[model samples]
Target: MVKFGYTILYVEDVEKSIEFYENAFGFARKFVSPENDYGELNTGGTTLSFASKNLGVQNLEDGFIESTLEDKPFAIELAFVTDDVGDLVQKATSLGAVLVAEPKKKPWGQVVSYVRDLDGFLIEICTPVEM
Candidate 1:
């Protein structure tokens, strides 16, 4: 059997990326490599991980397009569900996250907003979707 495990974002600074998530979203740090080139966050069921761009380059023979705040965000996004969408969005922005959209109530009864992390990755902050 196979299962989804974690998502790793290649960042310029592993430590700072992990720190940002910890400060902005309150995820606890799980571990960091001795070289500080990689780290993981204890994000419940699926871990959220970060690796330095150098590490990513070492792993992938072909270089990849790095995310940057000056560019448009990638198509995919990491969504965090919270009871208070507005507050979390505000907190994230205060911690250097770029606000992409303000919280709005969806037709499905979910309040959702968007932000770009320090790495310029799109993040969706929202209330849990009712099934």
Candidate 2:
């Protein structure tokens, strides 16, 4: 059966990205490869992983492109659920994540905000849905 798994982000430094998630969002580190080119984090039901840019290049013949500090984030985004969007925004920003949008209340009564991770990956922090 097909099921959703983890998302892997290509980064310059896997260890630093791993630390960023740990300090910014409180995700505990799962492990890092012995080669120091890959790392994973315990993000509840699904994992969040990071791979070195070199690894990405080695894996893809055409070489995959990724968001850069000089470029805008990719179209897709990773959404994180939290009770306090403001607090998480502060934490993410303090860890070098640039704020894309400020927290705002949606018509459905949910608060949501957007930010870009150190690698320019889009991230959304919002209150947990009661459904």
Tell me, by lDDT, which candidate is best: 1
Per-residue C-alpha lDDT of model 1 across residues 1-131, encoded as one tens digit per residue: 99889999999899889989999999999999999999999999999999999999999989999999999998999999999999999999999999999999999999999999999999999999999
Count of backbone clashes, every candidate in sequence:
0, 0
Q: Please give, for residues 46-92, the per-residue lDDT of candidate 2 as tens digits.
A: 88999999999998879998778789788899999999999999999
TM-score: model 1 vs. ground truth: 0.98
Clashing pairs in model 2, backbone N/Cα/C closer than 3 A: none
Highest TM-score among the candidates is held by which one? 1
For every candidate in turn, the CA RMSD to the true structure comes to 0.6, 0.9
Which stretches in model 1 have alpha-carbon errors above 4 Å? Answer: none
Residue runs of model 2 more than 4 Å from their true location after superposition: none
Whole-model lDDT per candidate: 0.95, 0.93
